[model samples]
Target: MESRFAEPSVLILVSLASGPKHGYALIKDIEEVAGATLGPGTLYGALSRLEQRGLIEALPAEERRRPYRITAAGAEAVQAYLEHVRQVAAVGLRRLGAAHA
Candidate 1:
């Protein structure tokens, strides 16, 4: 199978790039940053995959919550992914602008 990060996984990494966060915190951050609300199952599922891929790491539990931080590889991944997104958006915007002109 092709090993590609899903949109939710990308968003999770994006959120963690700023700092570490627990499950609920990650969910809220994703909603705030991406404007998409992930259910508990979806959010935790992405977190699990991200951890398995070494994109993020879980810190020791603080109280009842365990937070995960992005690894260096995760930051690189985010940078590359955003660049791709930027290129696509720029081209699409240019096309739309010309169409309206």
Candidate 2:
């Protein structure tokens, strides 16, 4: 099922792919990597969904902050999704270049 929160979900997954991170770390990482800012609600909501889907798992709470890591399944999913995006981007760029030429 597609989620209205797809973008944030993907961003979170991608960030976690790098390493486990708590909510605030995730926010900073995602912002640094993607130039997108996720508010607390959006970050937590996507984290819950990812956890429920078995794509991510939360580690033990450390100082009241829980870090999350991507599962093997999550890594696979993100790789596939990014490959598809790359293909689409390449085609779009090629078409734009052709039109300009």
Candidate 3:
């Protein structure tokens, strides 16, 4: 199945791939990798959708903020999505090579 991960959701998932993280940390990491900033509401909204889709789970509150971890199914979905991207990239590069030649 196509993951259809939106930009924010994909960034969140890629951030969570390393480990569980609270909202603030996710924002920082996503900025570092994605070069885009996510406001609190946007981040939490994506988090909620990921949770609802069973791709992620909110951990019990450590204090006021809750952390989140990726589910196994989520991991699989990310992998599949990445593989599809890789294939697309390879094809595009092949075309680029031909154009360059």
Candidate 4:
């Protein structure tokens, strides 16, 4: 949870917050939304960790691809993390504006 992989984990969770998606869909969604391209190694590594932590669960494979969905705990964790990010960004922006003024 607390590692260099945290960002990717959060991105994955946020992507799943909308609905379930397979590996390739998750990669595309993260790239499109966050402008960060996750290689297969990084994607699957984080996926493994998240699964171990109970933040996500893999659904039955559709042909060759396995879709994943965010659990309730995953939603709660992501919501809290994002809220903290929003607060930090708000403060930083306010300070920057004050300094400029």
Q: What is the lDDT of every predicted structure here?
A: 0.88, 0.92, 0.89, 0.93
Candidate 3 per-residue lDDT over residues 25-74, each given as its tens digit:
99999888777789999999999999999999999998898999999988
What does candidate 1's lDDT look like per residue over 5-101, in tens digits?
3489888988998899998998898878777788889888988998898889999999999999999998998899999988998999999999999
What tens digits encode model 4's per-residue C-alpha lDDT throughout 1-101? 32234489999999999999999999999988777888999999999999999999999999999999999999999999999988998999999999999
Off by over 4 Å in 1: 1-6
Worst 10-residue lDDT window, candidate 4: 1-10
Task: Output the lDDT of residue 28, model 4.
Answer: 99
lDDT of 1 at 16: 92
Residue 4 lDDT in candidate 2 = 36
C-alpha TM-scores of all predictions: 0.90, 0.92, 0.87, 0.92
Higher-ranked by lDDT: 1 or 3: 3
Give the lowest summed-lDDT range of ten residues in model 2.
Answer: 1-10
Query: Could you tell me the TM-score of candidate 3?
Result: 0.87
Task: List the pairs of residues colliding in candidate 3.
Answer: none
TM-score of 1: 0.90
> In terms of TM-score, which candidate is stronger, 2 or 3?
2
Give the residue spans of candidate 2 off by over 4 A.
1-6
Q: Model 3, which residues run further than 4 Å from truth?
A: 1-6
